[model samples]
Target: MTTQTYTPNEEKRVYAGTTMLMIGSCIGASLLALGNRFSNLGWPLSTVYMTLAVIFSFWGYRQIIDACTYTRYSTIRSLLIVTWNKVIAEIVGYATMFLIFGFLVAYCVISSDYIHSIYNFFSKTPACNQPAAYDEGLCNEYIKCVAASNKVDKIIRAIVGGGAFMLLSFVSSVGILSLISSLSLILVVFSISVILGRCIEALIKGKLAHDSGGWTRREPPIPYKPDVWSVLIDFPSYFSLYTLIPTIPSLYAEMKGSISEKTKIIHRTSIYATVVLITIYMLLAYVTSATFYGSNQENYRQDNILNNFSDNDKLVLSVRILYVLVIFTAFVCCLFPCRAILLDIVKADRTTKRGKVLFFVTGIIIVLLLTILAIFVPSITLVFDIITSLFGFVLYLGLPILVGLKIPVLKARREYMEATRAAMHRKDPDTEMKQTNAMEAKIRDRTNSITAFLSVFGPGATERVRQASESIVRRMSMTSDRLSIGGRADRASSSSGRRLSSYRHSHIPFKGVPSTIPEASDLSKIETPPLNNVSLESEHARQQSRLQTIPETYEHDRNRVQEVTEPDTEEEETTHNISTRVVTEQVAIDHSHTISDEVLLEGFTPPKVSLKRQIILWTITSLFIITNSTSFVMTIIKIFSPKGNTGVCPK
Candidate 1:
């Protein structure tokens, strides 16, 4: 698709799209499903889980953003490929695609259900012909009407709706994407306000009952206490709330900012977006639970929370229509990334005929598969839990940590080598030197903190940290040749061509070899002195002095040497001097460009690490592993559990 490309430091007229998109993405049909999921766990437990997720997710997001600051790769897949091996990158990349696909399928299913809800709400029923509050008998009659409608006809409608959504997303231009993204943000805020208003209104009217810390009935007095088992089982469903993490990287790429300030911009925007999300979720959960959760109304916990409200309520009907718009735009938003991943994996150039065929064929297959799942499988929570729990951990936590660890090692080598190479060439190495020093200092501080923290856990922990850091440096060294060779060639070609040609014609200083042969010493034995501490100005002065003496040395040679019996001896000596200079220059050029094994090892070594930071990192890592494993197990249980959805709709 055609798109606008901005220069790195360009200014924009509005708030960054990353912030708006993050907010919009977080507020979708998922909100409709969350009320029911939270009801299963009491509000207290749900709040705790959500709070924990936000905290950890923010921490993990920060790590990924920091890693992005070091590279120019816009796609997470490309970043992963560079940070890790291609195999691991491919696996995680495809897994991320699957995650997005699952969410899209869930959206399709919910949209279809909402459409039916709207149609049934508007159609006249025999049980109660007039507008009134929701009644079991009346709802049952409406349900029966929907059930009795042509199954084939309903399926056809679902297919048409889903297919159209997929097609619209597939063909959308960059401008269209941007427009919908902006609109989705506005719609999200509006919908949340309306929903929140209705819930608060119910509370104000005393329609919602609250007793002590628990939601209870007057006659039964049964308290809702969520057990740990229930929390663990339902955790994935709620944790899926932060499934927006992977998409943030791409949004950061699109945001306008200078290279130095991009990370800060995205991080600040993320904080704001997250606060908005937390406020919306917590308010909706608190108000909705107090209003519709527990008591004899437990059956009112429908997948689509709005289904609990009376279909006759004009406000709820408007919300439903508004939600449909949100879903339509959100579906397209998600489709863009999923489609991008698919194209990337197949290595398709969308502008080509072969690529066009593959794009349509894959797009059709994806739409059809998801449409089938949305139609046949009825539970949005289960699908969400399974997909999000498994892949969310990988994208949100696992890969970010792995990628973060590798970045310092790669960065250290690149910056250090750049500085060292500049120093050898007598260029102004000040900028590169400062950057190298800063990187090293940063790595040193991090390492020291890690080692210091780990010391409390005994020497074994500290040793492991040391070993891991060394191993990373070693692995990076192995890859340095490829980077260094290409980098040097590019710098060489881009350097001043006229200067290089002049240097070749005239005797000029080169590293590791003398500019001319000395009569008193052999070329191999004449050692090249170290110039590591040499300043740029001093080197320039020395070169100019050497140039001035060149003509005088020629005059001295001509005057001092007597004419031999052979007349052409002077010509022979001049020819020999020219050949010797050229040979020495070639040798110097070769030696200057080649990086030895000894230099590579010394320059690419990691900074010294301490114990404290090691302990902190280990603690966080252990927690991550525990959470991922728990979620994976929970996802399995969620998938196999016979407990089906019990709600107003068929699902």
Candidate 2:
């Protein structure tokens, strides 16, 4: 009961393995079942649509990948939730679930045919000795002979196949699904090789009917079409090659490396898959149509293309086995997304043991339920057709493409950048200036302090505040230098000993470069007095003569004595001046630095893609929806009608 883990060696290769997984998923039921419908597109147009499908699917799926990887949404459901509303998220999420489930159910439902066909071919009987073309009819007759047997063996075998599918899916690890799909990819390639080989053999042997034998023989028809509108209507089915989309995101998540690396995987996948698909499809279409399009048997074209193979054809038997193996393996792995989506909806944590058990049980239940429906329903062709179109194309392909067009990633990027720039460049003439003024006033008010007490300690401040405080100290230092008041009192006394002589003795004197503080009364006559020293002799003499005019009489100089108490006792003044300078110089510098507000921005926001490009994508997406939805409606209509496939002939 031990679990198996994949070693590094068991891991799928990032490039070719991813490509195989996709082709295995996409190349099932559609190719064999819808051969005639695609054959009607004509060989040349078929080639065109094949090329276009590869191009557009890669383009659209690339957008899906870009949205997830670039926007970081990561999953299709998450992408929908972010790009669309919550309601649309639920709608699409559930729709994706239904489509994947339908694919599994459809495969199981059709497994009955493969089983019945094989049983008929292998079972021994006199009637079974006939050509394999009549094996189905002959085998049914033998069932009646076996004492009321109604193909019981065939039903039981088909049920066993379905059960085995469920069993393999449950035991499988996530890596095992990749392994199974990769192996299935090999089966698919081999199957196509057989079909292509048979077609070539038929052509070389002249067994393939052609009009080169004259009007009596069939030849491949004209490359062009007579009705463009009808051809366009059926055009969406070209994407029958890309019926599933959830896997793109799922595969992309598992892929290791950069987006460019992952994209190279997708490019190789789409190109190689398209080439393989169209080559097989074209050969089948040309050989089949050239043989049977106008024949009376055209109306009875079987749902499976290989059923149309002649009883004598050796390749039909092998192709049937390959197609069955394709369906069974695809059914097993195709249900992976369904279980994963349900887990997502329920918010299950797969990392826990309980969550792992829950996921396993859910996978089993999904497979069993699908198997039961397939067993009971007998046929769900019409239902499969409708669900595939409505859910697969409309919901997965059409809506996502439209959303990519509508959401405007380019526009969102521009808007986010523009808003960011505007927010960064935002000037605050109100708050910034207010803070600057508050800081300046705080510095100025502190400068006006007249404390004479010893002061050296103050509150610590941020670096910006400390810088402002330091500038205040420099300003006070400049004022003190002019007054010769602080520790520089001895220099001032030495200067006053020859005060006017000191003023006149300057060798480097420039105009208005004053070295002394002017009295308030004299500051009035010179309205805006300069801070530099006064170098002009006449102006200096006037200020000097005014200073000398002070009276020595007590009555006349009463205010002058109080204002000019220049160190009444030299020791007392020296101590007070030392305390004042020490207090002013005491400052704390913070360690942190502030980032500047200025930004150097360049270039304007790039505008959205032109209206013309948008309209073209818009129109193309609309046509896809309309055509595919209409096709879904027709499938529903087919359920009530008992007509066989009315295969179209070349025009």
**Model 2: which residue pairs collide?**
210-218, 211-218, 512-533, 512-535, 513-532, 513-533, 513-534, 514-532, 514-533, 514-534
Model 2 misses residue 169 by how many Å?
6.0
Q: Model 1 misses residue 574 by how many Å?
A: 44
**Which ranges in model 1 have alpha carbons more than 4 Å from their true place?**
1-18, 125-157, 160-163, 166-174, 207-224, 227-229, 251-260, 410-418, 421-603, 606-651
Among the numbered candidates, top lDDT falls to 1
Top TM-score prediction, candidate number: 1
CA lDDT of every candidate: 0.60, 0.54
Residue-level lDDT tens digits of model 1 in 311-418: 556776777777676677667666766777788878998789987877767777787788877766556776776676677667766775676566666566557766
Instruction: Find the 10 residues in a row with the least total lDDT in model 2.
Output: 450-459
